[model samples]
Target: MRLFIAEKPSLGRAIADVLPKPLRKADGYIVAANGDTVSWCIGHLLEQVEPEVYDPAFKKWSHEHLPIIPDRWQLVAKRKTSKQLAVLRKLVKQADQLIHAGDPDREGQLLVDEVINFLGVSKEKTAAVQRCLISDLNAKAVKQAVSKLRSNQEFIPLSTSALARSRADWLYGINLTRAYTLQGQKAGYNGVLSVGRVQTPVLGLVVRRDQAIESFISQPFYEVWAQLETLPEDGPVERFQAKWQPSKQCQPYLDEAGRNSSKPLAENVIKRISHQPATVMQLARQHKKQAAPLPFNLSALQIEASKAFGLSAQQVLDVCQGLYERHKLITYPRSDCRYLPKDHFTEAKLVVAAITFNSGASKAATSLFGTNSEAFKSVDIGVKSRAWNDAKVNAHHAIIPTQKKLNAAKLTSTLSAIEEKVYRLICRNYLAQFLPAYEFFDVKAEISIGTGIFLAKAKEPIKVGWKCLFPSAKPKAEADNTDQESEQKIPNLHIQQGLKSLAARLDEKHTSPPKHYTDASLLAAMTGISAHVSDSELKKVLRDTDGLGTDATRAGIIELLFKRGYLRRQGKTIFSTKTGRAFVDALPDVATHPDLTALWESRLTAIHDGLSSYQELMMPLQTQLKSMVVDSRSVVPHGLRGLGSKAQYRKKQYRKKRPRKSKSSAKV
Candidate 1:
């Protein structure tokens, strides 16, 4: 009998749907009439055993048990999923051939592989097992994937990378958490001070940002603008604004950013330029083109969703999962790559149609797509943008809408408000690829009033092609339309052309401190962190890699920080708690910076690419854990002052559940 093991029930059902008909649903496995069986693991049926399982002595948290390294790692069935594991064990023994179906990512690879190893399948059957990688749950995609199965041994390196990462996190988190909590107890703060590989660095970012904002000192700066009028060859004279530039002679009186510090110097420039004859010394004008925005990976989607709808990172990932698995509206949602395979370019027409047909015009009419969805119809479906580069596509393509024919009537009933919004966002980017490039003319003028130079910039629109699709710019993107240059319309002028200078406009401004970390910016910082490293090559590698953790895990790490009282949210802004700041201050530098996380991420990627081994990654991490464990005991920890004063306040992470009304209350 052929057997299929999927990552989850939904995926199992999806696989079973495409199999031969006359299927019988067993307790935990599906039996096809053709003697094929399909079963699933609930997330992970087997998990790493806790430290206590290694030895009874390790059950109690003690400094002596610091750096608790198990001689051999072991896996046991989770209590909640023990039944599922039993089902798999029975099915695995009966099957003649096996197919491993897991999500096409690192975690997915490891979860299914570990299950097979734990099931004690024979070496011959394991070596010959077929691997099924499914990124989309639609019947057509799944059927196509099943037809082209590969040997599971090909992905052993990927599984090894994940195994190394899991064990490394365990060694670091379990050891350091025990060590630090002990120190905190001695400091009068009786809270369990958890330290994680990813969570601590993220908390450090917030705490350090808060500190910088507190210490910043605002300084007054001065600027001079020339209200110059153009002398056109014909028609009415047009006026435009230009700003004065600091000359090399004014270096002493100007700040490093070239903002004038002397009020008297600014007054002189204002007097000199007002009503003076100005000559256009330099003129530059050329058309520029901007391509459509790329489709989102998980991180990009989370960041944009946070900025647009104030949704938390975890909220966005949850909604994405619903859209992918439940509704089948999108492809994979946990992908880190933003580029699409060149082969997928052919499906543009159908994807656009699916989104347009499923507009949910009546009940779910959105401001983005509206009832008509006319924007998609006009998308010239042949214009393949740079987003279709095959070289950049990795693991999975960008998160995208599937070619599944969506039912408009059922969409409103099946999807929530946020799910609909996120679905439309994915569709919009996919449709944008078929639109033309945004073309504009960048016009600049360099005006001179004696020795002082003034400059003006304006952009003239040539074609509002792709820009029509996006009315407003997403935060921190290249499409920010809020700038003055994009709005300004420059009049006709030539070099050496004479112009009349109007009254000068001078405005004083103060340098402001950096803004607090919001949910959006913090997530952005995690995936694309500016690693503070001196090695040029390693720094570039870190910047290129997924920053602190995988896209699938970053949201969880942020959520963990909040649940542990290490971070708090006020409106959209995130701040480190007093306990959080104090904890960071007490720890060693390596424990609080992105450098360590960056190094680990690069090494893991090397393992995935077949350049490194599991030992290469874990050996150093194990050594580092030993050193940190020693420091935890050797160094004197200063407790969080006044932390236990109202210990209950920090302990109240979750609200109590309200009791249901009694029968008497219901009668009333």
Candidate 2:
């Protein structure tokens, strides 16, 4: 008998579809005619036991019992999945061969391995376990994966890395959260001042930004626009706009950003250039090409969806999960790698066909980019873009549409309005790879007028290319950065061409403070947090890592902040609450710094790559934690006061809840 353990039931069914059948549904598994069986873990069937499980004395939160470190970590079946676990234990004993089919990532690797170890399968069976990695759940992809099963032992390092991450988080969160919550209670704060390895640093970002905005003093800046008209040289006179660029001689009067800080200086430039002869000092048209943006990785998708639809990060992730598991429309939804495996290029036609017909219609009726086959008929499937690179592909390839053929009705049955929008968004980005590169001419003209240099810039589109697929986007695509810059229509002109300044327009503007964090911008900040840190050495190390959390956990961490009353949203803008600001301001640097998290993430990656061991990463963490807990005794956060206070209750106080009489009256 052969037994297959998959990460989740949806994945299990996908694996089973390509297996030997005359398959019958058993209690918690499916049995094939050949006595082969398939079972699954519901995310994780077993979890690390709580501190109380190690010793009864550590159950209460007290300064004496500060850092609860379990000497020998243990796992027990989660109550909800205990039945499924029992089924696995029975099946594992009867099987002659075993196959592990987790989701081909670090957490997926650990989920099943933890189960196998908890089930206490024999050493021989464990040693002989075969690993099957399936990123795409389509019949063809699964079949291909089945033929390429490798030894499970090869992925032990990946499992170890995930275990280290899990334990490190547990140690950091459990210890510090308790320590801080206790200190907050001492300072008369009623709520739990919860802190985590990732959540606190994220909240700190918002708190600091708010402070910066509050303290910022707006300063006036000036720019002179030259309304220049070209000389009639074998053609009708044409008018163009240009901005007065400050000369090097004007350095003393300029601000650090090279903006004209002195109003008199800017007025003088406008006065001198008002009726001056303008000669073209430089005329350059540089041809450029921009390839399509790569396919959706979880973080990228979350960020884009948030920007486009005002959908929250958690909302986008939920939609992607349904698209991956329920509809089988996309590949794995939690991948971080943006590049696709080179081999996926072979199935471009099939995937394009899926998108062109199977995907539902566009949300906006007037939008040029629709999901109908006619909309994508011009897509050249043979034109492979730079997205397909074997070396760049990580544990899982980019999230893309699977070639599971579907009709419009089937898609509508599977997707909601928001789901459809995100799905179409994913499909459009994927189809873009087959389209031609967006070609344009980068135009720059520096006008010499009365000893001052005035510059004009414009992007002349040579061909719409891939941008045609995303025409008229309301939120504006990230790749289409033309909106962020000043541009004007430019005509053919020769060097030293004579032109006259029609008029000088002085524009006075105030320097605006930084924009508040939104779901889209916050996610972007988290992914590129290296910019926030001060140390050069730490910044270099962090640049190699994804700043704060994995693609799977970032959304949840942000949502968790809101749940803990650390953040509030007013429309699309995310702000730190008074409570949140107080908590972050009082916390130590280690608890609020993203650089340390980046270092930990890099070491975990090292463990995954087999360059480091679990002990090497975990030993120092335990020692550091012990010191933090000891300090937690005297570290009463003074800022935890002045917000309306209430009684602080222990964790066990919420063991039972009063039942509501009516469904309508129930808190959702």
Candidate 3:
């Protein structure tokens, strides 16, 4: 009997539907009349246990028992999926051949291997272990995957990488969590303080941004603007405005004795303008142009959705997952590539045709350039870029609309605005790729006003180009930045039309501080391209590394921050909790610095590319982690030293406020 194992049950059923001959489906297994059988594990059927699970003595919370490292960790069935696990164990025991249909990545490999090991299946006795790679969980993908399974041995390196990563996380999570939790309890804290290889550094980012905000002090400044009107022969003066001399850049316009004015800049600019007529000094003009956005991938989608609709990373992920697994409308949802495979253009066209009739995509489809057009062929593929490597592409190409087709009417009216925006973005980019390059006319006119030079500019789209894909996608806010202006083109105007100033008004503005970290912005920052570090070589290394975590894992990492009460997002900005800030304060800056994680990532990539040994790359981190355990164990406050008196007072007030309940209200 051939037993098929998939990443999730949905995928298993998808495969079952495509198998040849008579297919019989069961609660836990599926059988084909030709005798091919399929079953699945729910994501992960087993996982490593905590240190406490190995020794009861390790269960006690005490600083003395810090760094509770386990020897020989055990793997047990995930509690909620025990029944499904039992069924899989039975099927694997009796099967002659096995097909691993889980995801085509490291974690997926581990999931299948762990199960096989648990079932005591000897590799030598098994007929074969085939790998099934399906990107979009659709009938066609599943059918195609079954016909082309590769031998399991071919995936050893990938699985090894996954195991190494998982084990490293386990070692850190288990050791540091126990170490910190025990220390916190010793210091009279009620909640467990947890840490992870990724979480600590992520929290560091939030805390640092908040400190910058709190420490910032606003400074007042002044400015002046003069308004003027011009004759119609000069084209209505184009609303002339003026800039002050060098003295205006500073606060030198004080009354007698250089005393600065207490009045606001708006009042001052108006007063200065009312005193005299403005004069023309000089005119300057320059031309500018912009290009269309590249394409959509999982990270870009999440970033855009969060900006456009205020959706959390996980929420966008869930929606995309559903779109892939249930609706079969798109491909994989965890990739970072923003470019399509060169050969996938044919498939891209079919997918576009599928959505154009139902959704607002038809208008975009009509404006699309032909697939064979030179305009579509100019995009740089960067053949040497890792992001574009064919070998790195697994089950699916990047997250793209599938040729399986789309029916916009089938989409629910209740679909989130974010979902609509992201889907449309995909369609627009795909369609734009085939369209003529968007052309624009830029007009620049310069006019001098009273010893100052000024410039004016505008852009006019000469060709709608790919922009016709989603005419409605013009500028939206907070999470999305799509609009006619965002597309690069030239403004309509000639340099020699003569000029005229219709009107001019002085405007006053304050220099604003850096904007707070929105989810989208925070995601970008965590990638660790820091300028503070003195080592240019290290900075370059960090730039080449993956930021924070992989796309497949980043949502979970952010969710972890929420779960641990380390961070929370209000609207779009992410704020660190008091506990989170305190945790950051407790850890060494360099230890939790984003640079370290970036360095680690760079080395890991080097290991993968054969530029460095895995042992050399990992040994330093392992050593650092051990030193961290020792240092943290000795130094963290024993009784909540960092939380300050507010927490204590809150606890006191809460205890004092505990009121007696009415007898009838007491259920016990």
Candidate 4:
């Protein structure tokens, strides 16, 4: 018999659907008429053993065992899922050949491979063990993947990298958490000072942003604007707005740091340009084209969902997963690649047809490319676009609609409000790739009034194109320093024509502090942190590596911080708690900085590429653990120090407000 093991039951059923069916369903698995058995793991059947499982003495927290590095790592079946593991083990023993149908990633490779190890199956004993990599859960994609299975040995390096990462996290998180918690207990606080390789750095980002906002001091400045009317030969006088630009020597509104700080100089400029005749010195018009946005990667999707629907990062992930696994509406949801493989153009056409008349997307499709028009009938998804580059594709392509079509009424009735919204987001983005680029004309006019130069500008849309699909989507605002006149409509005027200034006024404005981070902006920061690093080599390495965590894990990491009481949410904005801020202050830069995690990721990449060994990476991490333990031993835990007084005050108030236990209860 041949056996197939999948990462999840939904995926296993998807695989089973594609094979020759008439499957016999069992308690935990299904066997096909062709003698192929299919089973699944909820996720991971086994996990690394806890500290107590290593040794009883190590269970008690002590500074002497500060850095607990196990001589030999161990794994045990998760108690809740052990029954399913038993079923898989029995099948493994009976089968002569095995097939691994896990997700196409390092963690996925480890998930199935670990089960094989647990069942004590060896390559010498089994006839053959093969690996199948499938990204989409659709029947066609699964069938194609099954026909091209490769040897499991080829993914051993990825498995090794995964193990190294798991062990490194365990060593760092377990030891550091215990050390900090113990220190806090000694200081009269009661709470676990939980830490992780990625969570601490994420917390640091929020705390620093909050500090910057609190410390900011606003400075006032001014700008002068003129309401002018053109001397026109055409209909009605062409009225427009213009902003005055001070000369280099006369400009004093900006301080040394280039921040707005002077109102007097602005007032002087207003005086000079007021009640003056202006001549149009230069008029220029330029045509521009903006291509459609790239398809959704996991991070980009999360950011967009957070902004559009006010959904949390975790909520977006959950919805996308449901669409991918349960509904079969979209492809793999945890992808990082924003581009599709060149050969996928054929597949793209199939997906486009599937969503052409979807629940909430039919109107967008019909409007962008008229329902019965030639453009709609001959929709060209193979237009040599930037979104179709093979070099940009990594392990999986971007999140796209699948070729599995469903009835419009069924879709609308089955999906929740958020799911419908997310599904449409994917559809519109994918459909946009086939439409013409959005076109516009930018007009700029410079007027001369005495020694001052006034500027007027406007944008005129030539063609809506892909933008017509999203009527509700707003254009991103220009930078703060951008000329306000550029955002206004400019009346038609000839060069060298004279115009009269009706009114001139100086408007005072103050420098605003940085905005608080919402889930949207935080995800952007986490994924783009490498761009802020000073070291060129480290930045390059980090760019190649996932910035903080894998797409599969970043949302969970953020969610964990909230559960641990290190982060608090107000409306859509996220702020670090007092405990979180003090925790960052107490830790050394080595522990809190993102650079350390980036370095580890770089090493993990090296291991993946066969340039370095897993043991090589582990040795350095173990050494760092020892040094961190020693350094942390002398440090005091001040995270909860500030909260001590608040705790005491609350306790006192509770005692005073407490009603004495009723005499009736005592008698009972």
Candidate 5:
């Protein structure tokens, strides 16, 4: 009997659907007539035992048990899924051969490998153990993957690395949490302070942002603008706007950071340029091209969804998962890669055909590219594009529409509003890849008056190209804050043409503090932390390390902060609580710094690449944990100070409620 194990029930059903049937369904598994069995784990059937399970003494929080390290790790069946585990155990014991059909990632490899180990399916028990790696759940992809099964041993390094990560998190979380909670309890606090490898650093990011915002002082600044006009030979008089720039000799007042600072200087410049004749000293027009935006990786998708639909990061992930798992309309939703494999270009035609077959999408495509035109035909099939590059492809390709034909009516009827929004984004991005580049002309003009030079600029779109798909998308100038002049059309003018200023005005503006982090911006910061670091080597390391968390795990880490009351949301902005700020301030730098996470990720990568063994990777972490615990002993605990104050408030209330016995007792 052949046993096929999958990561989730949906995946198990997908695998079964591809097999030659007359399949008989069991309580928790399916059996083909040919004595083959298919079953699944609801994520993981077994999880690592808690610290208390190791030793009864470890059950209670105490500093004496600091740095609790297990000698031999243990796994216990998760209570909620114990029945599924029993089904899997019976099937594993009865099978003659086994096929591991899990997600093609480190966590996925460990999910099934751990189950097999828990079931005691040793090498001698099964005739052969094979691995199946399929990214898409469609029948064709599943069958094709089954035909090319490899040995499970090939992925042992990944499994080991994943196991090391789990244990490392446990060691840090359990030990640090106990040490801190015990310290807080001694200070008369009554709250548990939870900490973790990923959650702490993520919380640190929020705390630091809030600190910057609170300390920022707004400063008022001034700018001078002139509206000018030039009479053309035949057409209407052309008018445009320009800004004043004072020369160095004028001794223009500037802030310490070199920002323009003087209201007097701005007023003087406006007075000097008002109603004065100005010559266009320089007028340059440069044509430029912008490539289509890259396809959605999970992080990018989450950011866009947050900005466009006002959905939280977790909500976007849930909707994307539905699109991938339930509708089977997209590939994996947890991918970190934004580029497709070079060979996937061959499949692009099928995806395009699927999109063009849908009534709404077909109309949009026709309206933009013109039905029966060469441009439309090329994009509807396949074209060479920057999005297809093998070197940039990682564990999985970018989230894209699968070749499975979508039922347009079914999609609108079945999908929720947010799911439909995300699905349309995925489809539009995929269609954009085959379209021509967005072409535009960049226009800049410099006008001189006295010692000061004023400038104007504009961007004129020459071809809508891929941009037509997102008609409501903001222009680059507006999105990037390039220049206010870019929003208007630049009138035609000779290099030395003389123009008269119609009006000059001074505008008062204050330097605004940094905006609080929205889910969109925070996700960008988490994924692109390299831009924030100064060390060249560390920046490179962070870029290669995949940032703070995996796409699959980042949402959960952010959600964890909210659940623990370490972070709060005000409208779309996130802020750290007083308790959260105290927690971050009290912890050692090693515990809250993002670089520490990056370093660990680098070592994990080494393990996955066969450069280091899991033991070698873990030795340093274990040492770090021991050192951290020892260092934490000397550090003062201040995170739960609020709890102590609350206790005092409650005590005062109790005293007030007591009977007035003090006066009677004194009289007696």
Candidate 6:
């Protein structure tokens, strides 16, 4: 009997629904008429041991159990998920061959491997272990994946990397959590302090941002604005605003006290520009082009959904996962790449048609791309480029709509706002690639007010082009048929010849502080910026690197920060706690640095590429962790100040000193 194991029950059930044959249900396993069984693990059935596993007594929190390290790392059945483990064990014992149908990612790989290792299935009992790697869970894709499963042994290094990561997280989480909690308790604090590798660094980000905000001393900066009213060659009066040159420099003036003094630049600039009627000096017009955007990855989807639908990062991932695993309308959920595979072009039409049947954009796309049939093949298919490199794709390509005819009925009640956003993001990107570039004429007019120069700018799009895919970019104004025209349909005019000044007004404005980071903004910051260390090589290595964490792990890392009280959400704003602030302040420069994450990621990639051994890659981390801890402890912890009053705060480090052998040795 062949047993197929999916990542979760929902995915297993979805896969089972499409299989060839009469399927019978066993205890947590589905048996097909063709003597094949399908089962699934509910996420991870087992995880690395907690500190208590070393010694039963260590289960209770104490400083004595400071740095718990076990000789052999053990896997413990997740307390709440042990029932699933039992199901897996029973199915594995009875099966002739096992199919690993986990999600196609590191976390999924690790989850399945841990379950298999825990089952103790020997090579003698199993004929073969096959991997059913799949991006889309549609009927055809699922069937194709099952029919062509590869050996489990082929993904050994991937599984090893996952296992290593899990082990590392456990080691850090357990030891650091215990160390912080016990130390806090010893200092007379009653709260349990939790820390982890990802969570700590994640928290540090929020803390640092909050610190920057709190300490930000706003320097009052000013700008001068001159508003001008102009009669266009073919339209009604239009008002435009221009700012003074040397925006920061001001003309000095007398104070209200009748004493001559250099007044604020804003007042001076506004005063100087108000006395003149703006004159038409120069106008230049040129065509500008904007290309279509790429498709959605997990991170990109989350960002767009957050902005469009105001969904959380976790919410976006959940919706996308549901669409992929349950509805089977999209491909994989946890992907970082944004380019579709070459072969996906054939499937692209089906996806486009499916979405078209339901939305106006479908008709628009069909018109723009010459129907689904003529659309895809006409474009660059199988064009191997850096962006579309197949070698960069791991288990799955970027998230995209699948070829399966999306059940209109299924999408009706099941579609969430976020899911709708995801669908639109995919559909828009797919349609955009084939569409023409946005054509616009940038009109720049320079007007002179006496010696002062002013500028007025406007954009006239010759064609909506790819920009039509974006709902915001579509033209909303009606066409101008009358001799009187709107900015939307206005024609080109010579500056000095056609220009007529109607009125002039001076406007003043003040600059504000930078906007706070939203979920979308923060994700962009994590993935976009050059947050690397001072080392130029390290910066170069991290340049254009994906992000702080993989798409699968980023949400979890953010959640971890919240759970650790490092970050808290109020409305849509995330703020750092006092404890979080102090923690970041107390941490070594490297621990909280994004460069460290980048360096580790670079090394991990090296390990993945077989350029470095895992041991060698991890040696630096191990050394750093030890050294950081040692250095941290040696310092008089300033974090202690916020712990409470000094009397109960400072607990001298406990050392086990040898005692003088009492007369008990003599008696013996």
lDDT of 5 by residue, 276-307 (tens): 88889999999999999989989999998898
lDDT of 2 at 44: 84
Candidate 1 local lDDT, 1-668, one digit each (tens): 99999999999999898889999999999988888889999998766666766676776789988789877787767667888988998999999999999888899998998888877778899999999978888998888878889999989888888898888888888889889877877877766677889888888889999999999999988878888887655467998878888988999998877789888999999988899889999999998998989999999999988987899999999999999999888998999888998877877778877877787464444466433556656788778899999988756789999988767777766789899888877877887888889899999999999788998888888987776657664444454222654467777888998888999988787888989998889888887765444357767676465578899999999998887788899999998888899999988889998888778988888888788888888889889998989988865457584473445334222113222221110000
Task: Write the residue-wise lDDT of candidate 6 on 1-668 in tens digits.
Answer: 77788998877976787776788887777777787778898887765554554566766765455455555556667667778777888878888888888998878877887677667777554336788888887778777777778887777667666655665566566666556555555445445455566566666666667767777765434444466655554477665555444422223442333222332544555566664556667778888887767777888888877786677788888888788776777888898777766666666556666655544434334433343433333344233323355666766677877775544444545676456556756765765666677788877667676566655566777987666556442344543211111243323456564333433433332324556667787776666545635567777776475357678887777766666556778877778766677666655666676767666666655655556565664556666656555554433334644453334222221112222221111000
Cα misplacement distance, residue 590 of candidate 2 (Å): 2.0
State in Å the error of residue 519, model 5: 1.9
What Cα-based lDDT does every candidate model obtain? 0.82, 0.81, 0.61, 0.77, 0.76, 0.63
Which runs of model 3 end up more than 4 angstroms from their true locations?
53-56, 61-74, 93-96, 117-128, 220-291, 360-395, 404-407, 413-422, 441-460, 469-507, 527-535, 605-614, 634-668
What's the CA error at residue 169 for candidate 6, in Å? 1.7
Clashing pairs in 6: none
Q: Estimate each model's TM-score.
A: 0.92, 0.92, 0.75, 0.86, 0.86, 0.76
Better of 2 and 3 by lDDT: 2
Q: Which candidate is the best by lDDT?
A: 1
CA lDDT, candidate 3, residue 13: 83
**C-alpha-based local distance difference test score of model 1:** 0.82
Count of steric clashes across candidates, in order: 0, 0, 33, 0, 0, 0
Question: In candidate 4, what residue range of length 10 has the lowest lDDT sum?
Answer: 659-668
- Which residue pairs in candidate 5 have backbone atoms (N, alpha carbon, C) closer than 3 angstroms, thus clashing? none
TM-score of 3: 0.75
lDDT of 4 by residue, 39-149 (tens): 999899887766766565766778887789887677777667989998998988998889988887778888888888767786585336898888888889889888988
Task: In angstroms, give how far residue 597 of model 5 lies from its true place.
Answer: 1.8
Residue 566 displacement (Å), model 4: 1.1
Candidate 4 wrongly placed segments (more than 4 Å):
123-128, 153-157, 226-253, 256-259, 277-285, 360-379, 382-384, 442-449, 453-457, 472-484, 489-502, 531-537, 602-617, 642-668
Return the lDDT, model 5, position 210.
87
lDDT, model 2, position 652: 34
lDDT score, candidate 1, position 594: 80
Off by over 4 Å in 5: 93-97, 120-128, 151-154, 229-237, 246-252, 277-283, 359-378, 473-483, 491-502, 532-537, 609-617, 642-668
